[model samples]
Target: MLSTPNKQFSIEVTSDSTTVAPPLLSTTTKKLFIPPWKVPETKAPMVFPTCPPSCNKEMSRFNLDGSLKDLGSYGFWVEMCGKLFLFGRRFVNWEQNVEECCKIGMTPIDLELATDVKCINSLIGDDDYRNRFSRYYWTFGLRKTEEVVSSYYWCSSGANITRNWGSGGEPNYVKNASENCVRMEFGRATNMLYLLDSNCGLVSGLSCQGPIIPKTCDSPVCPVYTCRKRDALFKTLADKATKVLIDPSKSGIWVTNDTRLFMISYPSDTKTFVESLAACCAVGLKLLSLHQEVMYSILVGAFNNASIRGEKFWTAATDQGCKKNFGFCSTNRLVRDNARWASEQPDLSTSNGTCLAVSSDGLLHDELCNTKMRYVCEGRAQIPSLLDAVERECAAEFKLTRSEVKALFNSTPDELREKCFLKCYGEGTGLFIDGNLAMDSIFAAFQRITFDDTKRLLDMYSAMDYCTNSSKGMDECDKCGSLLNCGQENSPEEFEEFVETVQLTITESPLILPPVKGVCPEYECIKKPDQVKLLATAKNFTRFIGQAVVLPFVLQLTVVCNKKFYVFATNVERTLSRNLAFCCDRGYRMATIDTKEKYDCMVQNRITTFLNLPPGTTFAVGATRLGKLDRPSWCYSDTEFDFNLAEDFVSNDTLETNYGIAISFEPPLIMKAYETSLHVVCEK
Candidate 1:
């Protein structure tokens, strides 16, 4: 095997003369000498020949033995400046191609400019190859070495070309940096050359350096280009849509199962709720429901470019006409199917004024009764008969009258009284009675009596009377000094018994009366003595009339006597011959005896005695007595006490008798003493 650079040839020397070399002259001898043939280094840098004067006009000519060979049609050639030139077109490894071109005294093609691209296209003589050459191609200016060295060296002019490294580059070996072989589009650096292992033997196009000949060319319509630009547009749109659709964080576009027709941003006036819902419906999407997932989806885009009231978005759920059923409705299936039944039987009475909208926080919310919001209208579903029946049953069971309810609850035990009160009256019950006299009275009465008695009494009174009477009775009970009956009648004995009861009970009850005038007379006189009466009489007095002026006329009287004083009667048949004699002592004087009046007017003319009498005083015998007295009589008997005048006559004999018989007469000494006392008192 003969390893030749750029060519693989096998030689067999069978004769002795082929094996034996011919004599060769030394370089120092002057005689003519021929150099021995030897293989050149395969990994060496490529050497290019000097250009002739007609180099741009014609192909370079080269001889077979390291000399310029003449251009020929049968030999491999390349074009130059639109002229046909002989150049190899057979496949060869990149290293061999570079050596072969160097042996033929030409440089491998290195494409850099547009003209260079055209030149390579012409040289390839195949459309596909020319197209690829214009885009990317390798050259012998770079080579491979040990350690997979990838480096290249300029061949045509020995200039270091370091631009346009495609993908794989960088030398692995020192020699590979000078190696005359390279692969195109395989480098770490773009627009540059790199080294590779010589054993790789990958084929590539050659590169050449020269002033490029211009060519008339048509504008490209389908120039080869990467699809990255178109791909980038698709990728951007997809990324945006995904963010909007599945954002757990709300910074970006929000989405829902149903598309929100418009994004209402603050500062941008948009359509009303109804109008927005209509717009969404035009595109075949409904407003979101209470389903959190679906609601989240629908409200995704809603907050994108709009101002919202709160975070919540408005849904089709409503409680306006649903006061009777104000709670979450179990219509999950309907909601999933985009259908909703009207709550409370669809009374559209105020439908025109209601609206729905989304809040800033992306939750569904409602606006004011008359506000215009972006509403999500929904289609109605039929109410299930079973649910309706259940509701009716509940309504029926809950019906109750106020009294029945009160009785049912009030019957509870004392332990439950507080709870029952709260249930019946709501909150504390003390305020119900505060400052209300009638209520307080009723409560007070209840405390005083048993519940049964209170109920009976309350029933007996009319509503108006109950209130007025209760208030009045409360007032009386507060002040009255008698036992209160609370408007209930008691037996006479029981009434008496109650009176004997303590004053506190009397004050608390309502039956007692207020104070008034008048007394029970049957018991008044027995306890009082200043009101007794008396009478005045004279002897033989059938008719009597007298007038006396008395000062201090309001004197109270009291009389005590044992016997009745008498007034005598006159005899009509005969008049007594004797005249009634009247007598007066020295201080007692009888003024006149009047037969018509039948009494002597006796006046005590004693000054001290008369002056000593109190004003309005009168002296009389018993008209009514302290013990007991009968009609007036003259005979005072049966242990009677009396005052009467006595008369007597007396005689006395003188003691000196002898001288003359003299005689003397005297009244009785007691009577004489009376007469003498009366005369002596009168003289004083």
Candidate 2:
């Protein structure tokens, strides 16, 4: 829905263009307040205590496989005396350095490490890294207030500072000025370090400490793979972007390592035809189609690997409200002749309706439109139109030239005009809100546009966080420019990958069918006085059943062969003796499956009702095993014993208890049990 910006536009001007009038007001604005140190007159110089002798102890460097491992995205990491110290290359203000450490999942060098001059010297005092470590380096130490000169404490641990003060009683607490942050300055002549109280806004190199964990190629914190901290902001975005993001391990979705994404909802979360469409739409996906055997096989394989057996998931294939031949709901493409089907499937009988469901065996089955069943959803990687629209709109509003816009991909503009342009772009894309970096919004937006290209999105997301953290303390306009610059300098591959993906045109797929007008199913529940009363009674009975049953928590009610059935299973486990009393409380008795027709109906519904139930879940029935395990007798004085029901249980003696007949949903069987607690199926 977004349009390209025009190359040129006309602006209204005065008819007599010979002379141009100057504006009445000055375009530049004056600063409301300025730091005392920045003033031309009365500027006080920074003071530091005398350099202390370096610690003479030999400090050993931490290593993995006889070599120091790369630990972070930026700054050189040195492991000494079982700790990781980061010598930052870029010089930034104190606050920016602190934010940088946090972005890399580290903290500013705390008091314990700062006091160890030997460890610090081992990292930056040597020739290999001396030039990169700037003159002043920031630490976690801070003075809480100027009123008390000794109020200094380590910001990371809140421990009081008793020693490690620079010579000359350094914390002078300069009058009429604030200097709360602490920094260590290198002495050029002595080749030693001196502690100084510096303004928080002063630029300095970063010195940070990380967790003592060893960094290896396979470790999450190892820079060799990808350096990123999965902070709270990332977790929040993941929760909100379930549809567009694929976290294969726990998201109930899978990818073919190419582009297509597939997912399924099962059992308790089943939906009807119209409800399924709405559910998929809510999550930015569409109902999946199994038009090819390979596609169907992949889903079946994933389900099998997940231990999902004997389940059916709805697909987009249907013949309703269209031509008589079965076709996909959206594309209207006829179902291929080779499409896998169950034996005697697509029975075009009016009773079966027209929709189709794919079973776990990779076969399709014709089902009714209103039948509730688990359904599959699908998505693919493609740039979202909403993001494209936002980019074009922001560029046009800021009036960025085509060349300037193109340059933004590989380099950040240094001019004021380009800085403001980046600010507009950041706000429009939700990377920044109210002039502050919003990592959560940025991640969500990226997931929405990239459609869960995990490899690219994660890399870019990490680079963006590093850039934003590195730009802390800058004015909003400059902050955007600095962030863009940092991104280009640090992670060029991510930017190139992003550009390549964004340039690809999205292939549109028809996701919804035309309105199914005037072809509603013939069955409809009409409101009538007596029928309404019956419905209310049924609702109360359903609620009562939940309270009367035992373990397995059965709450389903079905009617078969003119008999009303109630499955009673509460959250508790109860023995057969207790379940009998519970059934009587509801004015019903344990179910009797005497006839073969009733038995068949129960088995059919059992597959649907017990699809998600736990194994070893048993329900008490109306039969009793009076004989040995070889032969069993029925209940009600042992008058009727259906050999068919007991055929499979004759060889299993563990199920033979003093109680009576019970059915297990997992194995779909009838067995004898007494002492064992079980759920109940009552029929009146």
CA lDDT of each prediction against the hidden true structure: 0.26, 0.51
Decoy 2 TM-score against native: 0.23
Q: Which ten residues in a row have the lowest lDDT in candidate 2?
A: 515-524
For model 2, residues 1-684, the per-residue Cα lDDT tens digits are: 111123111112122213233222221322111221131234332332211111111112225343333444345566776767777644456666665555444566655445467666654455344433445678877776546455677665556665555767556755513777787865533456767777776656567776555454321110011212223212211112211222333424443312245667745678876567666655446677664333565577667765778888888777664434566553323576667989988776663347888888888898886889988777543212324544454455567766778777567577766776677666544455445554332333343333324344444555565566557434566877787676566666655443332322112321111111100111111112232232236632243332222223445566665666777555665554455545543445567677667767766666225324565466776654322344444332223456666434534554433435566544545554554454677765
Q: TM per model?
A: 0.17, 0.23
Which regions of candidate 2 are displaced past 4 Å? 1-73, 113-115, 146-150, 213-684
Those runs of model 1 whose alpha carbons end farther than 4 Å from true positions after fitting are: 1-87, 93-99, 102-105, 111-138, 142-151, 168-180, 185-684
lDDT top scorer: 2
- Superposed by TM-score, candidate 2 places the C-alpha of residue 372 at a distance from the truth, in angstroms, of 77
Model 1 lDDT at residue 71: 28
RMSD to the hidden true structure, all candidates: 65.8, 31.0
Q: How much does candidate 1 score in TM-score?
A: 0.17
Number of clashing pairs per prediction, in order = 79, 4
